[model samples]
Target: MTTPGWWAMALCEAVNDKTPLAVAFAGEELVLFRNAEGQAFALEDRCPHRRVPLALGRVVAAGLQCGYHGWTFDGASGRCTQIPNLRTNEPVPPRYAARAFPVSEGNGFVHVWLGEGVPDIDLPTDDYRPVGQQFTGSTIVNMSHEQYLAAMLDGPECLLNFAHVRMTDFFLGDVRKEHGRLVLERGAVWTTQILPSNFVVDYPLIVRTEVPVQGGSIRVDLLSEDETPLISLAIASGANRRGTTSLCWRGFVHAEVPAKAPLRWRTARVWHKAPFTVNSLIDGSAVAALLEAPSRDLHAARPPRLIPVSAVV
Candidate 1:
């Protein structure tokens, strides 16, 4: 269901105006402004009369006015109301309306649900952790946001599995460092799956983190390991920087595990900014195997040292 490319959230600078709702769009994210009005009028970025970006204009008198020729457009109906050159007595001209879309905003960002037709999709605004400190932006993907959720559920193996992911030309390499390791690559797909229980927790958490300066990467996920969940939950900022935009993916999961009266906490973010690819390969279904892996897997006072969180997830 992934239409193409990756544009799952909001734009970086769309939320500058807190009181006056702003307009922003990119094929997938045609959301309206979010100001005191708590109002979002979804619409095509094109101008029906002259095709100027209505987003470049400002909101006026319950609608938006295009600056190109002083043509004003209604937010809900995409109608052109006043053309300065025309007389007031003249009725509104035909074929002068923009395409208005349906949009909603919450969690400090706006969202557009893109498709040929409108369906019964409702946005949920609860129990979600913020990126860094706030909601960055919002978007309406041409495909299903649920698919974005599904990607995380499957883990990165789909892209790693030899039977699954492929590209024009690829290479899978196995190198032996002081410790155990294996690396596989084909095109842009690079993955490393480690095994451990650093991801499971005994208490509620904001995704404890760390970035060790080493050749590897470590992440402690509070949610599922497959679907490569790092998408829907991670703080996206500088990920695809080499591309037109950069994304920083951050995922979060909170649950109660068996911990001591007060469990000690250590994170493995050290590998976050490392070279190549890095992530833990965890099969939690083997509880007996995991329980024997490390007490860090458990919340109670069981072990002295623990593996990174990403390894255990």
Candidate 2:
């Protein structure tokens, strides 16, 4: 498989007084935390000697204390440096080291590399810029990585198909976010926006959701085809008080159609019993890729790599 760039397959979050934070972006467990000065670090979640989840341990004295045997490792390196039983303070045991990951810190969140040494740090600054977006509140759904992405910027059809947005009843908005114009490939310019409540998730802030739109340099306020603004569907979400929420934005322009999906909708959630805010994995190349069907007999150990169509674009 062709290895994608950094942002294509990564996620970041703060330690939040919780060391050994369970990270799923990588297929394995990783212990991530901030030190006294608030610098973040990531290490293989396992301890070298017995492979215990170091995350279960605590951060004290600038190092991580393994929960099981009280073995301590330095924050910068996974080397086992301190053993309470030994009278002599020694360098970390020669071979007792765990895998360490290099981290990039920005926008109040921490990003890591899963493939090899340092991937691109050249990510979107405006992408994570807080739009102060608001929604009904906070709730995490079990959608796969793909659906979470498509639900975001799949453009017009997405409202009617996945998001229950009816084009006839409600118009959609700008297909792209920030800087780039959401125009077609050298075609006639058509811009759109939706009438959902104005909730935006800009960093460090939470405001109502008002779908934004831009096409061929013209910005259009998305609304219903009836010509009335349909901004009532909006709901607000909780603000990131810790100022450490990791925000991501993806841009996908495909010459072909979207990736294969299980069920395509014509009228939105007529398939489901109720409306859900978070994206759902309903049998498509979306989140199901993480389900790992061939291994239905066994449990998976790590997160699945999502094929980013934007990376192709």
Model 2 lDDT at residue 297: 15
Off by over 4 Å in 1: 1-31, 34-36, 106-108, 124-313
Error of 1 at 14 (Å): 4.4
The number of the candidate with the highest lDDT is 2
TM-score against truth, every candidate: 0.43, 0.50
Give per-residue CA lDDT, model 1, range 1-313, as digits (tens): 2111112234334532232233322222232543345455655666677877766766666467666776777666667777777876997865677775555554433444443344224332222344432213222222222221222222332211211111212112221122111211212221121222233232111121111111112122321212122212332211111112222233332332213211111121222221112122323342222222111212122122212111000
Off by over 4 Å in 2: 1-13, 124-126, 131-140, 147-313
Model 2 lDDT on a 0 to 1 scale:
0.38
Give the C-alpha lDDT of model 1. Answer: 0.33
lDDT scores for all predictions? 0.33, 0.38
